[model samples]
Target: MSEHLTIVEHPLVQHKLTLMREKSTSTASFRQLLREISLLLGYEALKDLPLTEIAIDTPLTEMRAPVLAGKKLALISILRAGNGLLDGILELAPAARVGFVGLYRDEATLKPVQYYCKVPADLADRPVLVVDPMLATGNSSAAAVDLLKERGAHDIRFLCLLAAPEGVERMRQAHPDVRIVTAALDEKLNDKGYIVPGLGDAGDRMFGTK
Candidate 1:
């Protein structure tokens, strides 16, 4: 286990998260708020991105400026819920490469079952940011990350809207190198393995499928 987690406490992120947590909030409002919050979280998640100074000619004068160091970032969405975060982050990092991993929870096993996966061939070359809205048991997140690692991804980060302590611990034990960034760390997971005080099923809430 390792200390590789960040809790974002921006006022805007907290405010929108509060709105999303309300049981009475509509699907449209929840989706919109999620988009807004993801933008903020994405900004925080990318704060420490490697940078390099580059010489460039500005309108005023020629000078060196700091720019992202490596190739374009790779954003991996963990199925349905991750899509919500993916869309919002894409609004900010339009040039970033995108990928998807479809992992459905098997009720009996309470583990992730990957039904779909496709990523850029250069995953090992660029920084990879994996997005999932909720990290409950962490089995799926861990499994997804394992798949990436198997594909040669080393520099990786996990981003989520909410996380439970148990899930965080699970990730810590499973993959210490991957840093986790979340908007809020909730108390615990419920009987059915949902984050306590979480915004219900993120996929259901965001898509009005509940």
Candidate 2:
């Protein structure tokens, strides 16, 4: 989590990502793979969560056991596609507070346009994880972080399925303190601001929409 970016190279994660990337993969299969891979990515993302020990009694003896410390995690999904990643992470951290930021790219400008936003209270007191499947242009991701900061979110992390170098650099420049975790970092983005060699539009694939 200290690094600006962490790529999850677990074999299971990579294998599932390959399946999800295939054009022939069905909507059902893609959605399932995303959920499956998201757990692995979430594992890497949450590895550095602070821990504290507390005394607990075992069947035979009592001992100090470690448990998560500090406030409950706040998970903010960056709209529709982010919801796909959100599901698996929720399964991983069932008690995490949930929020959403709705944004879409303006085709001509390639900038993010926000339409909706609703977040949990006391963001400043909790660690935040922003979920999104693609980090193509980084405009939306950066904008999402901007909104979170406005709401007093300081400790934040970003999780995604795929990232382009351009997007990574963009986030680095915009929010250097926020760590980014992803299943894979592909090549540069296409002219249309889509990650090249990416699994296509994640929202479309996951939802079987055009």
Candidate 3:
């Protein structure tokens, strides 16, 4: 497995995370907190982005400066809950190319079925970061990665707000090469496939629906 998983434990992130977990937190606050947490999480996820030295001038002297290496980053949101994390990451990496992968859960099979997917061309050439809020069963996430791989995404990372152990294990088994970055690793999932103590259906919560 790639050593790409990093759990950010900053006080601010933890604090907001707590508020987001509360059953009483309003949808507006939940959305705002998600955005804030995404920025913090994104910061941790992009810490190792390649950097190259460039000749530049300071206020008083010319010097070599470091800048992001290679082509721009590509942020792909595994909609629609992924959009929550996508917003803040975009704020941090405004220039990064954006893409979307929409998958819906199949009630009978309990697997993710792709409904829509539109990614940038030449995925193998760009560093792609896939964002989602809850990595519950990891079925959708894994399927999304599979599609990306089919399209030639060699270097890809999965980012999420929360993850269940089962989901993590599933992803590890399915795609050991894909690194997973999340805010918290919750306990095992419930019989219903929901992460224990999870904030509950991310899409529903984020949109203030049932």
Candidate 4:
């Protein structure tokens, strides 16, 4: 989590990602793949969580066991496609508090427009992970982070399925302290603000929309 950007290059992650990128992949399969890949990315993203030792009684003996330190984690999904990643991560961290930031791009300007936002209280005390499937233009992701900071979330990390260099740079310039974790870094964004060679529009494919 200390690194500014971490690409999860695990074999399983890459394999499923390949399936997701295929145009002929069915909606059911796409959604399933997203869920599976999410678990892998979630594992990498949460690896650095702080741990503290606590005394516990094992069936055989008493010992100090390590457990997650501090408050429960806060997961803020960036609406729509973010929910796909959120579902699998929830299975991994069922105790985590969940929230959502609703944003959509302005077709002409390619800027984020917030429609809804509701997050857990005391964000300053918990570790926050913002989930989104794609970091295409980075406008929405950066803006989402801005809103979280305004709500007092300092320890924040960003998790995505794919990232474009433009999006990564945008996040770095906008919020250098936040760590970014993704499955892959594609070539570059297309003119229309989509990641080149990405798995199409994540939300569209996952939800079976146009």
Candidate 3 has an lDDT of 0.89
Off by over 4 Å in 2: none
Measured over all alpha carbons after superposition, the RMSD of each candidate to the real structure, in angstroms, is: 1.4, 1.2, 1.4, 1.2
lDDT of 3 by residue, 57-173 (tens): 899999999999888898999989999999999999999999999999886776998889999888888888999999999999999999999999988888999998888988999
Give one digit per residue, the lDDT tens place, for model 4 in 1-210: 237999998999999999999999999999999999999999989998889999999999999999999999999999899999999999999999999999999989999999999999999999999999999989999999999999999999999999999999999999999999999999999889999999899999999998
List the candidate 3 regions with Cα displacement exceeding 4 Å: 1-4
Model 1: per-residue Cα lDDT over 1-210, one tens digit each:
236889998888889999999999999999999998999999988887899999999899999999889889999999999999998999988999999999999988798999999987788898999999999999999999999998889999999999999999999999989899998999999889999999899999999995
- Please report, as a residue range, the 10-residue window in candidate 2 with the lowest summed lDDT: 1-10
- The local distance difference test score of model 4 is 0.96
Model 1 sits at a Cα RMSD from the real structure of: 1.4
Error of 3 at 65 (Å): 0.6
TM-score of each: 0.97, 0.98, 0.96, 0.98
135 Cα displacement, candidate 2 (Å): 0.4
